[model samples]
Target: MDVKEGNELKEFNMLYKEVDELYHRIALEIGLSDSAFFILYSIVEFGDGCLQKDIADHYFISRKTINSSIKNLESNGLIELKKGKRRDMHIYLTQAGQKFVEEKMMPVFELENGVFEEFTGEECRQLIQLTKKYVMLCREKIKETYHLSSEDL
Candidate 1:
């Protein structure tokens, strides 16, 4: 690749690492395990009563892992599980959980919003679109190399 493309690729890798580190650091600052923080963050972003399976699917994580996180969150009075319309469990944040999100996690959301505010609306939209396209390209490459489909995954 040319120099410009190579620099962009390097910056992308660095951004990924920096974001991951920041996520972990935020979890620590909020006194939550990384998994618990992620679970909470997902619920907050997606809304309450989200399905356990949905979360597992969203993260491409095993049900057992999500289940463990759910249990831990419930034990800490951060979340509650209720029977859904089907046999699935619907997860919701408790009053304490809401408080925790407001106190500990909202700052992170605000910070992200503040950063986004630095860019124009169109720039942000284009960035998201391009990133999603890049992700799909990588996924397709992985599937092709592995001879696997989404169903297999």
Candidate 2:
């Protein structure tokens, strides 16, 4: 879709709706909630040295939300957390977590390729750059709204 008729906020919502649906569908297929699966998938992809706060920072999710999701992932034996030097906690994926992520993401990538493979290499690179740009924009907006900086997160 060209998205010729909508404002930035509208385009944002449109993208979010599709993204949410895909995530929810995939999560349901894997017997997990969309949010939990995303959190776990992220931890697995990024490896365990990621601080608990960094997950929230990277994802633009609230610390409290990530905390609860991490707890659930931990209780399921899918992940573990180790206390760091200060108040920080490091996250690591378990054996089950690794296998689960690999199995679930293979089809997800196939779906992505089927849908987006038409884009040229330049276009693909542009999309990645745009995603990074939006992430930074979101970080600034979040800092404005929540009074929390990435430095402290």
Candidate 3:
């Protein structure tokens, strides 16, 4: 690749940084880091309480990072462990966590939605679906670049 190509990729990183900054600001206002809010959001959005390792697997984040985020969420009274038949711990949000998401997170999402209000309803769904697919592809590519297995990831 030429210097021009390299510069374009670097510019892409700047765009990524801008998007991350928006999410970070929205998360901070609710008194939770981006990582913790994502975890709680995923748990509440999905009916099944995810196992610790399962959550790490689905999110493509390091087990250690997930553990640290879980710890922080637990400390903040946003989530709790549900002991059940399985050996792995099932993580769920507390009532306070749900309430916070309802009150705080809903507004944050509203702001984000407003930022993209140019899109129609169908366009919004398609965009979100494509974004998730693109993110998954990027994660898979990163794992391959590192010669790491899915388990290793």
Give one clash count per candidate, in the order shown. Answer: 0, 1, 0
Return whichever of 2 and 3 wins on TM-score: 2
Score candidate 2 by lDDT. Answer: 0.79
Question: Predictions ranked by lDDT, top down?
Answer: 1, 2, 3
Per-candidate TM equals: 0.87, 0.70, 0.69
In the range 43-152, model 2's lDDT, one tens digit per residue, is 65576568878777777778888889888988998788899988989888788877776787556768778867889989999998988998798889989999997895
Error of 1 at 36 (Å): 0.9
Q: Which residues of candidate 3, in runs, are more than 4 Å off?
A: 5-7, 112-117, 121-153
> In model 2, which range of ten residues has the least summed lDDT?
40-49
Q: Which ten residues in a row have the lowest lDDT in candidate 1?
A: 1-10
Question: 97 in model 3: Cα distance from truth in Å?
Answer: 1.6
- Candidate 3 per-residue lDDT, tens place, 46-99, comes to 644777777677766678888899988888887888886757778877888778
Between 1 and 2, whose lDDT is larger?
Answer: 1
User: Candidate 3 clashing pairs?
Assistant: none
